[model samples]
Target: MTTVLPDLRPGGGRSQQAVGMPELLQVIWHETRTSRAAIHRARPDTRCDLRISASAPDRELIGTILLDGDCACRDLLVDMLVECDRHLSDRAGLLGNPLGAARVHVRKKAVHDWIRRRRTEVGAQARVDRIRTSALALGLPDEFHRALLEYLADEAGVMAPLDSEDALHRRLATRCAAEFGGAAEHYRARVAAGMTLVERHCRSGTRVNAGTAAEPDKVTWWERYIERPMGRRPRRTDKPLVTAAPECGDGTHQPPEPASADAADFDAQVVAVLVAALRRQPVTPDAALRAGLDDLVSQGLLPQRCAIELCSDCNRFALAAKELSALR
Candidate 1:
């Protein structure tokens, strides 16, 4: 006798009694013999030839049962299938259509969800692998590596407000240079290399480069003072030089410049003062002038009679040095 099997439902549910033989066979193949062992044991006897009529829904249900290892409803489906098959065989008049004419529809949501989940997992693993590889390649000490990672994360947080990725990268480089005591250009190069490796392997398309912000220039204390219009004056006061008695013939004492001296004489005296100031190797203009005057007096270059006149000339030279130093 040719027994027609019922069609299988989309989700492996029991077939309806009103449905034809095609649907019945679908249920038997998909819901009942879902496993290889079940299929082997449930084979029909040689005298009772059995034929299956499977639809698209039946194929999908069978595929899902085979693929999903943790399908909790399989036992329930198997029990339902056995009951249906027994009922169908008991009624000899019932008939099922051929498998070719059967049409079945399967819900695609589960399949789609499974694919999406797999992709997400793959992407997450790729990211993890990329990070681990990059970290190992860095070869920094464990403590330093941890600190560097923390610093980078903190920097990224600070840069979150930046609208442009390029700008953010550049700012990060600048900050890294300042905090880590490395050249910004070098830091940028390293960052770029790391990002490139990540993008290539992880398939993340994020791009970052160093920012254009310039570091502030350093100014020296001397430069700071000299840049000003009025330079700092010497703090030291002039002290009288102790000299040997003239009777010893160490040097002749020249007379001081008279108040009524000619303009030429006054100009000559001013020139002498500046020449003295330039001779000293002191750092500041004020110190230079003071040391110059002291050297001239101690070396007996200046006459004892011109002590007052030379002192007054030294003061003028001090002012002149201030202006010259400021320009420099």
Candidate 2:
């Protein structure tokens, strides 16, 4: 006669010690034999088969029951198999995932809050300041509070004017922009760069050698000479390099000249390469610039300064280094 294992659900509720392989085996047997939902929910089709087994005994160790069964057991065994495979595959990171990382982050945050709350010696202002610092560290945008407040109000069923659909949407949009604008800009730059490259590569059709291009300095000089003329016609009345006296010049600072089509094309290519790199990962300004520089280097163009920093300086990107730096 097949002996039935005891239900074990309530008896196995809590444990001071960590779970081990033996406990896992008990849980699986209990779940399969007693829990109708566990088996019925995992209805395996004809194609799949379930199998389980304990690892082969090594010196001084005994082997536990290995689960082996038909399709139903195979489906259930998949979870265990994955864990085993992970150990064999990449033992160091076998079970790591983004969701697990996020859970750890949230737990840490809660622990920090609990510790702060328990410190009776700390003043309320100090507590508030600590929270603000933590928020800044987590890269919470300034606008996040407004959106959060609105959301909480709505969730609590508060009938406040600010909870109106229009107000809520506006609040959400503002927060999203503040939180994600930099990331969005980086993504946009990459897409634009890729499209430009595809167009150029397709249009050019023939491979061109970089050796044919003029030296970078020669090119710069030629551009300057072409754009403007050299003449010793008039020496501007002596102006000291550093002086308290206001430097005399035309009231208006000249805007940057429109780029030539070729220059624009080169820029588009650089943008494309950097954008592609950013899409793959969050790049440091140095890394993004390096990617752009690599493309320029390949094309025999002078490497310009870091692209993101230049964009920041020019007020092209919504968020600045100072803002993202706050997160770090």
On TM-score, the leading prediction is: 1
| lDDT (CA) per prediction | 0.39, 0.34
Candidate 1 ranges beyond 4 A from true positions: 1-239, 248-282, 305-307, 310-317, 323-328
TM-score of each: 0.18, 0.17
Model 2: per-residue Cα lDDT at residue 221: 18
- Model 2 residue pairs with clashes: 50-73, 50-74, 52-67, 53-66, 54-66, 190-275, 193-272
lDDT at residue 195 of model 2 (Cα atoms): 29
Tens digit per residue, CA lDDT, model 1, 1-328: 2222234332222323344434543544452333323323332221212322243265544322221222323332333444454444444333353221121211123222332333233221111224323543244444333333334333322202332234435765676678678787777765555544422332222222212347443432112211111111112233456565655365765533333358776556555654656554334555455555565556554555454453344335546556545533
Per residue, candidate 2 scores C-alpha lDDT tens digits across 183-287 of: 433433333443233323223333322123563222221112111111111112212121122234755433223243587786675556556545443435333
| Each candidate: RMSD | 38.0, 26.0
